[model samples]
Target: MHPRSLRHRMEKAAKLLVIIQKHTPEVDCLFAPEKGEQGHVVCEFSGSGMSRSNILQLGKDLEARGYQFTRKANPWLGQLSYTGKADEKPTIILSLPVVKDRVAINEDTPATPYSFKEA
Candidate 1:
């Protein structure tokens, strides 16, 4: 069984997922595909270089909802944490699924590159 806190985190993640899906569009999905690791929020973005305006907009939207980013990788990848709770807690991580758009197709280009079951 998962810890209660983890459950809470996932619940929060679900809410964030709604927020991300509502905000992100496929066209602008360059830097981020459909989802990426984020606090309680699985998010998608435009690209590294303003490829999609949704990313910037999402930042603003997140701010409006009272979530301040904690850390990251490079300038555009890594982690996110809630405000005020920075001092406490061990660590918070958001696991977002890799976007299919970024995946490179092989010579055949199967419909689904990754499969849970091998036939």
Candidate 2:
């Protein structure tokens, strides 16, 4: 594809991301597609409180709007892709990292002895 065409697609994807951001209060970041790559945007969530649910719902909404989608694993639990022409449309990747509860280790605990001595 021509360089200009790729730029146009990226712009469109960025615009779509902005529109989506307006309705998604939990989105923490928005990244536009890089050069020479298919149109893609990343919607990152804080992954705390209602963020997980919100991102999941957003994924569902995208699917309902005729976007083909797939569930991502690990850190990013959500993703969506447009069903239309690949060259003309953009793919939305949802990033909702799993938030683990922080636990404070006892400070008084002794460190484990190393198997080998270090100089």
Candidate 3:
């Protein structure tokens, strides 16, 4: 990738991070390239209360501001791709990391042993 193009991408990513931070104050945001990938700038956010609906609403807000964005969904995760210009396809990929709550098991709890009988 050309240095100029990379610089442009970095700038765009920074702009996006500002917008995200303004809207989603509770979430943490970052602007950086994907590991081992060239010419790709990704906007990553992770924190409690970062739900899919919240992200979709953010995308809508961005679109209302004249920015083009698309939401990509997965079974357990989702992201928004911001393509402000034709040449910059998905210049920024907004990622919301899904964190699952873990329950701690108490060792003091007694477990009952069960035996299965052959039918």
Best by TM-score: 2
Number of clashing pairs per prediction, in order? 3, 0, 0
TM-score of each: 0.40, 0.52, 0.45
Q: Give the per-residue lDDT digits (tens) of candidate 2, residues 1-119.
A: 67897678767777666656655865564444563355667666554344444544555555555555544233122222222223446766555555332342222223232111120
Question: Which candidate number has the best lDDT?
Answer: 2
lDDT of 3 at 67: 52
| Cα error of candidate 2 at position 21, Å | 1.6
Query: What is the descending TM-score order?
Result: 2, 3, 1
Q: Which residue pairs show collisions in model 1?
A: 13-40, 31-47, 73-77
- Candidate 1 regions with alpha-carbon error over 4 angstroms: 1-3, 25-51, 70-119
Residues 4-54, model 1: lDDT tens digits = 656655565555555555655442221222122322223333232323355
Off by over 4 Å in 2: 1-3, 35-37, 47-53, 75-87, 99-119
